[model samples]
Target: MKKNKLEVIPLIDDFSQWLAEADKSDNTIKTYRAVLNQFHEWLLSEGMDLNHLKKKDVQQYITYLESQNKSLATVEKAFATISMFARFLKKLDVVQDIKRKQKDKKNQEAPDSLTLDECNHLLAEVKKRRQPS
Candidate 1:
């Protein structure tokens, strides 16, 4: 689909203007525009666009970001940009139900404890270092 078909680019431009008027930094405006552009491309690839945006669509986009191995911070930034855009369009409902995905327990788990042999080696080192104590 042509980028203009969804009219997203214009909205993004307008949104950037709004951000600037609201005293947003140049870097902040650039970041938000880049994120919205990326989201627009994703929507086009999915055979949809912002005009058809829905909560499920936003959720699926989040899933897509995770699938692409994007860092959690990147995904959250994208979500935040989209949310702000939705608010700009007076369509907050499109993303209101979406929630950021945290790393699963398996991903968040601490590193495995030291092995028994390693533990014994550490103890031996400590004992050797103990001078008259």
Candidate 2:
């Protein structure tokens, strides 16, 4: 049978209480709430209700985030918020530990492709620039 989606509304009270008890700043808690709300809305549109949240669902959301071209930092913050919320929901045994892998830096090129000769050439250029005329 298909699982149900997790309901964000029912979690608000306990989530807020947990955040407050943790001594999280008001802005931090507010950020968490915003992230969760966004995920919750996505859940609804994806035919999920909030009761059947799983790690895969979280992965899908991350994938969706990547597809949207959100920066790695943005995605990381979202994952952190989800984890915090999931930790709270876990106390109630309603949600799984929904942590995800950090997003890759899309703009940074991998260094493995550069040959040793290419590296030496680049280093020479840097050294040449460092030497004053």
Candidate 3:
């Protein structure tokens, strides 16, 4: 009998499993999986092997996501998930520190934006309260 083999993408599932076994909540695991799945999709498009990934690759991906108008926090979260996955694979320092854009040079207020998930949850709550049925 022939068996199917999975490469890096399937690792998202493995990492999710690890997170579950580590007692992470379902919501947390779901968020991690979504973030990692996006990264895996990017890797597939780039045709790069996980074993040969470098810090620059991580930076480029972040840049690509940002170019698409993604918020800084989302980019940061992607970096974080990739870094954690790298650590799980024993690939230390594969991700680099992404610098904040200097849009507000006058007074640098640290980023304090809610993630997409939080925004959606808030909207859902607002909708629930609006419907008095």
Q: What is the TM-score of each candidate against the true structure?
A: 0.71, 0.63, 0.65
- Candidate 1 CA-lDDT value: 0.86
The TM-score of predicted model 1 comes to 0.71
**Which residue pairs show backbone clashes in model 2?**
4-52, 5-49, 5-50, 5-51, 5-52, 6-50, 6-51
lDDT of 2 at 32: 86
| Residue ranges of candidate 2 with Cα displaced over 4 Å | 1-7, 91-133
- Model 2: how far is 78 from its true place, Å? 0.8
Number of the predicted model whose lDDT against the real structure is largest: 1
Candidate 2 lDDT, 52-127, residue by residue in tens: 6677778788879878989878888877877777777673233355444554578576656789999899999999
Please list the C-alpha lDDT of all candidates, in the order they appear. 0.86, 0.74, 0.74
Give the candidate order by descending TM-score.
Answer: 1, 3, 2
In Å, residue 69's CA in model 1 sits off its true spot by 1.4
Clashing pairs in 1: none
